[model samples]
Target: MGDKAAGGIPHYYLYGDQEADVELDLLHIEPIRERSGPNDWRIRPHAHPDHMQVLLVKSGGGGIRMEDRQLPIPAPGILVVPAGVVHQIDFDPGTDGFAVTAALGCLRTASAGDPRLATAAGRPAVYPLAGTGLDIPAVIDTFHWLHREFIWSAPGRRTAILAQYMRILVVVLRLSIAHQDAGTATPDRDYDLLVRYRALLEEHFRSQRSLGFFAGELAVTPARLNAACKARSGKTASELLYERIVIEAKRYLVYTESTVAQVAHLTGFDDPAYFNRFFTQRVGISPGAFRKQAARSEG
Candidate 1:
């Protein structure tokens, strides 16, 4: 069971239980072919609960699966798998690449104080290194350097290796966010407000659903807050708040055994009936039905 996937999705410590006897905070680097070729170039659906992974595809192509979604992995690409995300990959025969698996705590430490970095470290994504406004060669070089340091630990090697690891993460974070924003530049003040508002929402969505309260905390009027959200995302502030709550509701329903009433209470709804109505209106399905459908899909 240790090597097997939990719920049919393998739980791994660098593809197996290698970390079971070692320190939890460490990094492992190796060629993709080392593990994939021997296994027919296909990695089964699995997750690393305490680690995050970065795969650099130098040549050839493949497909990456993050939960129910499939993504392409072209040559000179990067795939990031955050901790606890079920993922799998299929590489073309003879595909060449490198993979780095690091402890999640190490990444969290590196990403601290940077919201964008923290966000990137919390999601699974694939990015094409070419034409991404990122320094492709430099990133590849850093990966190579880290691989060397990992294998040939010399004086100050651990610090050097982690510094390179942090560099790769910073580059990946910038490109990921830039791709999401799609080059749509926002004014500094508007962007700052949006970021702060989102951070606050993440913290208080379960207890505070009032748009006015959020705006007041940010020292802005409700109207101005709504305007900023609209200008940046084409959605009003209230819509965003409702969407966040709904998202959390869905996550709880899908990932946990929480009943409708429990989920309602967890998502700021004092009345189960009102929570049911709100979820049905926005999601077009009752919470119980949604959970059942999700279960069937997973099965």
Candidate 2:
């Protein structure tokens, strides 16, 4: 098990160096023990640049590390790791669960036309299934069906598997929102605005970076938008926009084979030089250096 770079985060294709034949838009499912058992039930800190993971813990408990936050994972819980979020896990010896990894593109497609699902797919969260509005047994059964279809290819298996995956996502989103709403005292209307802002950010963060544009689209002034975001998340609207852009830039730099200039263009930066400065200012490293560090870690 290789550790993270000396001063940089480790980028992983999956748990360890195991290669996954992940297509642009597809899904893969497997048991929790399959990958964790051989490694003493500990997964080191790593980020999946182009993939998202949902871990359903059926029994036992564990610790989950997501960037700066460390959370406990109790039995009968679901943890969603969105693309590019660094996470690590350590489970009790007998922890039983299923981990489903799906391409970000596929999740976007699955979440199309549904703002709640789209928002859930982009954010990382954990939902304890015991008291949430989710049907625990049904969700587990759906995960089992997905795993079966993934390993045993039958007629129309792809379609069936994807359908099951979507079902699971819907349930997870429902529970996730419920858990969030129950814990927060934010007004419903304010929360709804935040959700809509996030969905809009996901859609237009690339080409639209102006705070005024987002605020106008939401039918509010820039001050109102910033106030709502700050009241809910303690960050201004522009901060959130920049954070999303930086995340996308890092994802492209680490996962894709595109050149720095090309990556800048792809990430909506017209001037490659300006993009380099922006990335360095926010990420503490230049784009080329970041890519090289990721390559060294993978190597």
Candidate 3:
């Protein structure tokens, strides 16, 4: 009955018709179980008006259904549910964490002048943090501080709360970008493998490393690497390396006054003519032609 909708969806500060706590207009922090435990560990479809939620899942696992996508949120994870987006969560019994609800105005304040923070908060995202070298106890302590600062009339309480909130978001954004190249941006094994592969690729893409060498570095077979790149990036492992090379070649060609032969050599090719053939085969035109086309488009 707490449903507030112009379109039949429920709007709630928590899961039901609980009135907003006057003090939480800037933000509120509470244990995850306090509300969800009472609600059988399942938050039914609902949205918060002018508010967003960051679920710091310290333990337990479950899936959240946001809009049309349902993703699993394992322990040592973070969920950013943007304001006014309809969402539902079904957690395992004994699931634990803190739910920090903050107003949109507060987000704007925390993110002032930095749209990356705003952009990170502006969507519904689930990030897996296990094995990502996150400091779990430190994160827990951070939230504990948020809860404490939120509850008491301490010195600089508002400033402290906002600073903590902004700090948490910047970490999330970095992890997300690190996953994706800022990309291949999803939570899964293949995406994880792809993320690792891209990181290695970035370091070694300029040199002539065989797919097996890259795979060996990642402790996977070439087949596994190919499978991951194909699944998350829609390209094979070898293709990805080539794609990296082609990208560098294009950059040198379009951005610099370098000759195609010099660009080819810079990209690790010994023969400019061979580089021409390679670029032509991949790009449907030679490097020279592509550069001219880019220049025309810019002009």
Best by lDDT: 1
List the global CA lDDT of all models: 0.77, 0.76, 0.75
Model 3 TM-score on a 0 to 1 scale: 0.57
In model 3, which runs have C-alpha deviations exceeding 4 angstroms? 17-25, 181-299
Report RMSD (Å) for each prediction in the order shown.
Answer: 14.0, 9.2, 16.1
Q: TM-score for each prediction?
A: 0.59, 0.60, 0.57
Put down candidate 1 lDDT per residue, 13-120, tens digits, no spaces.
777554332223468899999989999999987767557788999998889887667888878988888665667789999999899998754675577667577677
Of the candidates shown, which would achieve the greatest TM-score relative to the real structure?
Answer: 2
Clashes of each: 2, 0, 2
Query: Which stretches of candidate 1 lie above 4 Å from their native place?
Result: 1-6, 181-299
Clashes of 1: 2
Q: Of the candidates numbered 1 and 2, which has the greater TM-score value?
A: 2
Worst 10 residues of 1 by lDDT: 181-190
Inter-residue clash pairs, candidate 3: 177-182, 180-183
- Superposed by TM-score, candidate 3 places the C-alpha of residue 42 at a distance from the truth, in angstroms, of 1.0
Per-residue lDDT tens digits for candidate 2, residues 50-102, read 56788889998788887667788878988888765667899999899999888
